[model samples]
Every structure is written in C-alpha cells, then in structure tokens.
Target: MSLLNEDATIPFISRYRKEITGNLDEVQIGEIVKFKELFEALEKRKISILKTLEEQNVLTTELSQKIHNSQDFISLEDLYLPFKKKRKTKAETARLQGLEPLAKMIMSQNVNNLEQTASKYTSKEVATIDDAMEGARFIIAEWINERTDIRNNIRRELERFATISSKIIKSKIDEEKAQKFKDYFDWNEALKNIPSHRLLAILRAENEGFIRVKIEIDSERILQRIENRIIKSQNNCSAQIEFAIQDAYKRLLFPSLSNEALSIAKEKADEDAINVFTKNLKQLLLGSPLGEKRVLAIDPGFKSGCKLVCLNEQGDLLHNENIYPHQPQNQTNEAIKKIGSLVDAYKIDAIAIGNGTASRETEELVKKIFFKDKVDVFVVSEAGASIYSASKIARDEFPNYDVTVRGSVSIGRRLQDPLAELVKIDAKSIGVGQYQHDVDQTKLKKSLDTTVESCVNTVGVNINTASESLLSYVSGIGPKLAENIVNYRNEKGSFTSRKEIKKVPRLGGKAFEQAAGFLRIKNGKNPLDNSAVHPESYVLVDKIAKDLKINIADLIGNKDILQKINLQHYVSETIGLPTLQDIVKELEKPGLDPREKAKVFSFDANIKTIADLKTGQLLPGIVNNITNFGCFVDIGIKESGLIHISNLSDTFVKDVNAIVNLQQQIIVKVLEVDVVRKRIQLALVK
Candidate 1:
C-alpha cells in the first residue's frame, strides 16, 4: 500500500521491489491495487454514513460499531436501510395517519383482540377498523423489510435459486431487425450457470426493446422461511403479522433482493467479458514482430487497385504508388515489371500483403514475379488499418499523404512491429474482443490500458525511435511527457544515452526513476543503459566490474564471469538476491527481444471463397478471434469458420484459449459448410 501510495507503478514495484513485496508477480500486485482502492472507497462511504447518523441523532454505540465493522457494500447498506430517507411511501403515509402504535401492538403478538385495538386508532383518515388494520399492516410491512436478518436471508435465496427469463415484445416479434435476437425472446436459464456471452446477449436483447427480462425464485418457500423466523404463535395477531409478511415479500423484499441479484450477475458478466478481452489484447500486442526489415507492402483491392508502399528499415515510407494486377484493368505484365523494379530499387527484404479483398490474387501475382533478392511473403490482418488511416494521429504523421497511402504504410509498419503501430489506434477498434460494445466502457478502457502498459513495459522501448503513442505507455510517462520527449529528440537529434531522458521538459526525477529501466538506448555511452538495469543500481555494477578487474563493457554478455559471481555478496538492504539475479540475467542478454521473429504463413491455394470449401476437407487456417464458447478461424476466405468448444479436442474443453490463441496457425478439418449463409463449422485436426 505504501509503495502504491508513493506513485510506484505495478510493473516497477513487481520488477524492482521484489524483497519488499515478497516477490509478488504483476497479477498479484494488480489484485492488491484493486482491493486497496475498493477498501478506500468503502472507508469513505462509512465516514459519510457515520456523519449522517450523528446529524440524525441516532448514532447508538452498537449501530456505530456495526457500521464500522461492515466489510462489504451490501452489508453496510443493509445496516443503514432503516435510517435511509425515502420518498412518500405507504408506511410513511400510515405513520402520518397515527397508525404506528397499532402496528407496534400487532408486532408484539400479545394482543388477542387485535380488531378492538385497531378500532381505537380509527379517525377521519382511518374511518373503520378494517381501514385501521390495513394501514397498520403497511407500517408492519415496512418494519419487516428493514430487518437486516430478513433481507440477508432473501438475498441468499435469490443467489442460490434464481431464474432469469426473457419474453419478446409481441408488437415487434415479427420485425426483420428483431430476428437476430429471436432465440432469446422466450429464454429461461439458471442465472448462476449462464455464460457471460449468453447473459450479455440476453441483456442486449432487453436493451434493444425486443424483450422484457425478469428474475424469479420460489416465492412461497422464501415466504415460509420468513414466517418461521418472525411468527411466535398462532393467533389474531399472528394472522395480521402474516398479512404483513405477504405484503413485504411481494411489495418490498423480493423486488429489492431480485434486482440486487440481477445486478450482481451483470457485474460478474462484465468482469468475465473484460478478462477475455484483456487476454486477447495482450496476445495481439505481444505478437511476433518482423524486426527492422525493409519491406514492400500492398493493400489489395479490385476496382481501386492495390495501394503499394515501400518502407525503409526504420519504417519510413520511401515511396508509394498503385498497381492494378487483377480485374477490369488486368495490366498483369506492367504490374509485375513495376513490382520487380520496386523490389530491386528499394532493396526490399520482405513483402507484406493485407489480408483483405483480392489478397489471394495479389499473392499469386507477387509470387510469380522474379525478384533480384530472396524475399519472404506475409499476409497481415488489416482489421483496423482503415481506422488508423483516417485518425488524427495518422493525419498528423503524414499531413500531405492521403488515407490510402497512410493505410498501406500502417500495414507495413504492423508487420515490422505490431505493438508500436497498433498503440496509435484504440484497442477496442482492433477487432480482437468479444461483445466489447456491450460491456462497461470505463472498465474496458482501464483493463485494455493496463494490458497495453504491461506489454510495453515487459518488452522495453527504444528511447530514440519509439513513437509518442508507444512511449506514452511506458511506466510513469504519459501523453504530455511523451510529446515533450519526442520534441526534445527531434530538436537535438537521437538520444546518445539514457541520462539524456531526464532532460525532457517537465520529466522529473520520479518519472525518470520509474521509466528509465524500461527505456533502452542501443549502443549507448554506458553499456548498462541498453540493458534492464536501473540507474540506481549502476554503482553496484561498477563495484562488481572493479572486483572482477574488468570494465563495465567486458562484464556485459560475459556468461562465464557472470555465473561465477556470488549473488548474495551484492545483496543490500534495498537490493536483494532477486534484484541481483535479474541484473545478471539482463546483463547476459542485453536488449534481447523476448518476442519471436515473424514467420511466413500460407493458406491452401485452391480455396478462395465459401463455395470452394467442402465438408471433410482438410485445410490450413489461422485463429482470428476467440470467445468463451468457441474461436473463429480465418481459412483464407471472406467468412471465418467457427470451431466450437465441444469440437476443440477429444475431451471436454473448459477454456477456449487453452486450446487456441489469437493469430495461431493450425490445420482444421471442415465439419460442415452452409454456403448460403456463409457459415463454416470446423474441427481441430489434431
């Protein structure tokens, strides 16, 4: 808590302060952060409630202690229910009519002649004994609803035995737009057992005005339990109390508890959906990179022609043009000659083609052309390329270029390094989430931002060449500071050492401490600047080098010498064995990228569309999107095929991610194909 309160980031605390944290990993530390915030919020609410109670002159010793001891929101609210100010209700109206004394008499259960007792309360407002008894019952019902034990019992019942049901609005049942949610129009399921995606679908159906959703439990059983707890004897007073219990169950208790149950379910569903999204986003961000390759990229189309751009090793756009190799303008010979000349002229090491519209045709054309050098070919997912092209960031980066040229450059850069280019666009628009639009927007943004930050810090950033978007995700460096760093770099040329990072305007000592270790400088003045070692630990490294009679440069990457050192000898109060071990490991492989190099993937050449697919045919595919129920695989066609969880393996599969990941290449056997609907069902070939 103290570490977090001091503005230390999760990645920094987990990586640098292992001794103080007992070596907790990032996930564990993140949980601590979440609960710390929750606890602080709870404490603030408690203080407000205590102050309100004092002002109301109802702060009894027992009630104050109970409120202080309450750990969760539900329990705290239950304790405060009776004292909470409410709008004009039946009980309040009855109290205003001077019927609370009769209500109290009935609750005591000692009055044998309840009707005669009720008659004494009759007046202009309460004309008859029956009217008086009815008013008294309303007050009794309110009292019963306020009992903490009664509300808790009902909450437990709802949690264990609730059913969620949805029905279509009859007026819109036959509308064409409502057909998509028809399956949920008459749905009933156990709320506790429903999957997140299914629950979100039902909720969305209700939101769209196509259905009305309700929650239900066994009302009679719950009422009986409440009666057993409240009733003491069988008499006229017991019967009156029974009437109150029935009213409370119907009008007050069940309604409130059922809503709470539904809200809890919805919160859990949101959490599950967000977890899936963050996992997928992390995988996509950490996907393999084609590092520092000069490449020719193409965005394929038929009528608009394929937009082509050649990028240098630093991902700068060297040139861009158009080539119509397919369809109406079948200038195949001219296109091939132009591509060959561009490859030789730009010294292109690889070719990247966007996997959208006419991609296969372009791939075939490119493969047939003879090149001056050996070049690998790749098909990149252009899911959010168009979004990036029209974005303000893209416009700022290339003010003179058009969207098409910007899009082609984005595709090329995505191949070079996905994390750097993809950060410029919103994570939700990247097409790697399940029901992203339906979940809580604030929570989705926070989780995705955390995932992006973790990924960026885990693979360290290059200080000199990283974009503002990439640098902003580095620990303790935000958008404003990132812009300052870039402006400083542009004005004074590339950074020569890590110490120069502190010179950026408004970047103070604390921010530098948190961000310096994660920012690497290649071939810097100090060799450790290119490694993961923090500047605070440089003196220790210098001492180790002096003891070994070698310079800092000789100590780096010398596995034999590094292995011979006793890690305990360097351990201090602040730097323990864990930090020393990490320092040695980083020194052994300074600036080594943890991600694998990009590989070339190919689809079956004979298949182009849904019509070409046949049941029982084996084909190669790439897993594109994943959900709780199944994953969708792209098999070189417009419509990706679904591999349901049941067919993921020979045994029962609980998690779809355990079997397949995003962008994973696999061979699948077609189980069924509905060409009319463009739906293909596949099974893992295993």
Candidate 2:
C-alpha cells in the first residue's frame, strides 16, 4: 500500500524491492493496484452517500448504522430506495388524495370489512369504495417493491435462474447485411452458461437492429415468493395484498431485475473479451524478430505495381522502386533484371513479402530470380502496416517518401525486428483482437498499453535508434521526454552514455533514474549502460570487478568469472539476493533479446484461394487471430480458415493457446469448405 501510495511502478518495486512485495510478479502487483483503486472508489462513494443522507434529514440511528455497515452498492441502494425522491406516480397521487389511512388499514390485515374501512376515506378524488381500494393497492405495491429483503431475494433468484432469449425482427429478416447474424435469428440460453463470444455476438446482433433480446424467469414462482413475504393473514385485506404483490412483481420487480442481470452479463462479457485481446496482443508483440539484416520488402498488388524498398542492416531505407510483374503491366523480364541488380548492388540477405493481394505470385517471382547470396524469403502480416504508413510517425521517419514507399519500408522493418517496428502503430489497428470495438475502449486501451510497456521493458530499447513511440513506453519516459530524447539525438548525434540523457531539455534526474536501466547504448564507455543493470548499482559492479582484479569490460559476458562471484558478498541493506542475482544474470548476457529469430514460412503453392481447397487435403497455415471459440488461420488465401476449439488438437482442448499461438505455422487438414460464404473449417494434423 505504501509503495503504491508513493507512486512506485510495478517493475521497479517487483525487481528492486522484492522483500517488501514478498516477490510478487507483475500480474500480482497489478491486481493489488487495481484493488486499491476500487477500495478508494468505495470510500468516496460512502462519503457521498453519507452526505446525501444527512441532507435528506433521514439519517436516523438505525439507518445510519445500516448504511455504515453496508459492503456493496446493491445493499446500500436497497436501503436508500424507500427514502429516495421519486417522480409523480399512481401511488404518490393516491397518497396526496388522503387515502393513506385506508391503505394502512388494508396493510394491517386486521380490518374485518375492507369496503366499510375504505368508505371512511371516500372523497371527490376517491368517489367509490372500489376506487379507494384501487388507490390503496397502488400504494401497497410501491411499499412492497421498496423492501430491501424482497429486492435482495428477487435479485438472487434472477442471478440463479435467468434465461436470455432473442428473436429476429420479421421485417428485417431478409435484409442482406443481417444475414451475417443468421445463426442468432432464434436463440435462447441460460444466462449463467452463455460464453463470452456468444453473448457478444448476440449483443452485436441486437445493436444492429436484427434481433430483440429479453431476459425472463419463472413468473409464477417469483410471484408466489413475493406474496409469501408480503401477505401475513387470511383476512378481507389479504386479497388486496395479493393483488398488490402481483402488481409489484409484474410492473416493478421483473423489469428492473432483468435489466440489472443483462447489464452484469454484458460487463462480464466485456471483461472476458478484453482478457483474450490482451493475451493475443502480448503474443503478437513478442513474436520473433529476424535480427538485423539487409533486406528487400514488397507490398504486392495487381492494378498498382508492387511497392518495393531496400533496407540496410540498421533498417535505414537505402533505395525504393515500383515493379510490374503481375497482370495489367507484366514487365516480368525487366522486373526480374531490376530485382537481381538491386540485390547484387546492395548485398541483400533476405526478402520480405506482404501477405496481401498477389503475394504468392510475387514470392514466386522473387524466388525464381537468382542472387549471389542465399536470400531467404519471408511472408509477413500487413495488418497495421498501411495504418502506420499513413500515420504521422511514418511521415516523421520518411518525410521525403510517399505513403506507399513508407509502407513497404515498415513491412521490411517488421521482419527484421517486430517489437521495435510494430510499437510504432496502435495495438487496436494490428487486427489480432476479437470484439475490440464492442468492448470498453478505455479498458482495452489501458490493457494494451500495459502489455506494450511490459514487452518494451522486457526486451530493452536501443538508446540511439529507437523511435519516439517505442521510447515513450519506457518506465518513466512519456511523449514529451521521448520526443526530447529523439530531438537531442538528431541534433547532437548518438547518446554516448546513460548520463547524456539527463542533459536533454526537460529530462530530470528522476526520469533518467527510471528509464536508464531499460535504455541500452551498445559499445558505450560504461559497459553497464548497455545492460539492464541500473546506474545506482554501478558502484557494486565496480566493486565486483575490482575484487576480481579485471576491467569492467572483462567481467561482462565472462561466465567463468561470473560463476565464481558470490552474490552474498555483494548484498547490502537495500540490495538483496534477488537484485544481486539479477545483476549477475545481466552481466552474463548483456542486452540479450528475449524474442526468437524469425523464420521463413510457406503455404501450399497449388492452393491460392478458397475454391482450390479440398476435403482431406493437407496445407500449411499461420495462426492470424484468436478468440474464445478458436483461432483464424491464414492459409495463403484471401479467406482465412477457422480452427474451432473442438478441432485444435487430437485430444480434448480446454484452452486454445495451450496448443497454438499467434503467428505460429502449422499444417492443417481441410475438413469442410463453404465457397459461397468464403469460409473453411480445418482439423489439426497430428
């Protein structure tokens, strides 16, 4: 609590102050932070409630005690419902007409003749005994509806046994666009057991004007339950109480409780969808990087010639051009000759092709052309490449180039280093999430931002070449500081050491302390600056080096020397075994990237589109998107196939990720094909 109160970041406290947090991981620490925020909100709500009650002059001893002891919002609201100011209702009209005494007489259930008692309160407003009794029942219904015990009991019943039903609007059933939701035209399910994806789909259908949804339960059972609680005696007024009980359940209780149930269900569905999105986003961000290499990337198209760019090992754009090798302008010979000459001239090591229109044809064309070196060709997802190309970041990076040229460059850079390149684009635009638009946008952004931050800090950043978007995710560096660092680098050259960052305008000691450890400068004067070791721990590293009788450079990456050093000898009051062990590990592999090296993937050449697919035919595919039901795999075609959770493995699969991951290449057997709708179903090949 104190650590969070002091505005300590999760990574800092988890890594440096292990003893205080009991060695909690980032996820556990995040939970604690979330709970603390919720508690603070609850306290504020309590204060507001107390103030409102005091102003109402209804803060009696019993009411005050109950309000103070309430633990949840539902209970507190239930206690406040009777005292809450309401609009003019039938019950309020009856009360204003001097019918309360008759209503009270009926409520007591001790009156012998209800008609005789009701006649005494008769007036111009209540002209007859039947009118007086009707007014009394209206008041009684409101009274029964506001009872805390009654509302709580009904809520429990709804939670345990509600059914959600949906039906298509007859007039819109034949609408072409509404056919996409045809599966949900007529559906009913237990609200408690509906999966998140199904619920979200149903809600989307409802929102699109295709279906009307309703929540219901056993009406007779609920009415009996309410009647048992409200009626106490079998007298003349008991019948009037029964009428009131029915009115309460039908007009008041059912509608309100059903709405509450649906709202809760929607919230749960949003949470589940957001969790899946975060997991998939994390996996895609941490996908393998094809380390620094001279490469050529192409954005394939038919009418517009393929946009191509050549990038150096440092991902700097060296050259770009347009090639017409497919359809309309098939200058095959000229294209091949130009590609070969450029590869030879630039010493290219690999080729990257965007998996869009004409991708396979371009790959075939590139493979046929021979080069001096063995150039590996890779097909990468172009989900957000276009978005980045048209963004301000792209303009800043390549002010002289057009959007097409910038986009081709982005595709190539992603192949070389995915985390570094993809961070420049928004996570939502990456197209790996499910129902992202339907869920809470603020919450989705928050989760995605955290995931990106964790990935960036885990892999560490290069101080000299990182873009502002990537650098902004560092522990303490925000947009302004990131821009400053980039500006300083551009004006004065590369950062030579960690302390040089402090010299940038608006960058103070605190920002440097939080961000320095995650920013690495290769071949710098201070070797620790290139590693995860903090500047605060440089004195300890110097001590270890001095004890070993060698230069600091010699101590780094020397496993033999690192293995012999006792971490216990370096422990101090603030530095414990965890920090010392981390330091030793960092020294062994300074600035080691956690992502794997990217590999080349290929699809079956004979199959180019959905029409070419056949049952029992084996084909290679890459997982493109994931959801609760299963994953969508791109099989080198315009239409991706669905690998339902039931078919994700030969064995029963409970979790989809336990078997496959985003961007993972695997062979699948075609099970069914619906060419009309451009859909394919596949089974995992064992």
| lDDT leader | 1
For model 2, state the Cα shift of residue 361 in Å. 1.3
- For candidate 2, the lDDT comes to 0.89
For model 1, the run of ten residues with the poorest summed lDDT: 677-686
TM-score, candidate number 2: 0.96
All candidates: TM-score: 0.97, 0.96
Tens digit per residue, CA lDDT, model 2, 1-686: 89877666776666666868778888899889878887787677777877888998888888888888887777878888887788998899999999888888898999987788889888998899989999999999999889888888888888899999999999999999888899889999999999988899999999999999999899898788887876889988999999988988889978887898888898899988988888898899899998889999999998899998999998999999999988999989999998999889999898999999999999889989988889999998899998999999999899999999999999999899888899999999999868889988888898888888888888889989898999999888989999999999989999999989899999888678778889999988898999999998999999999999999999999999899998888877888888888999999999999888898888898998788999999999999998888999999999999999999876888888888899999999999999998889998774
| RMSD after CA superposition, every candidate | 1.7, 1.9
Task: TM-score for candidate 1, please give it.
Answer: 0.97
- Model 1 residue 529 lDDT score: 91
Clashing pairs in model 1?
none
lDDT of 1 by residue, 89-161 (tens): 9999999999999999998999978888888999999899999999999999999999989998888888888
lDDT of 1: 0.93
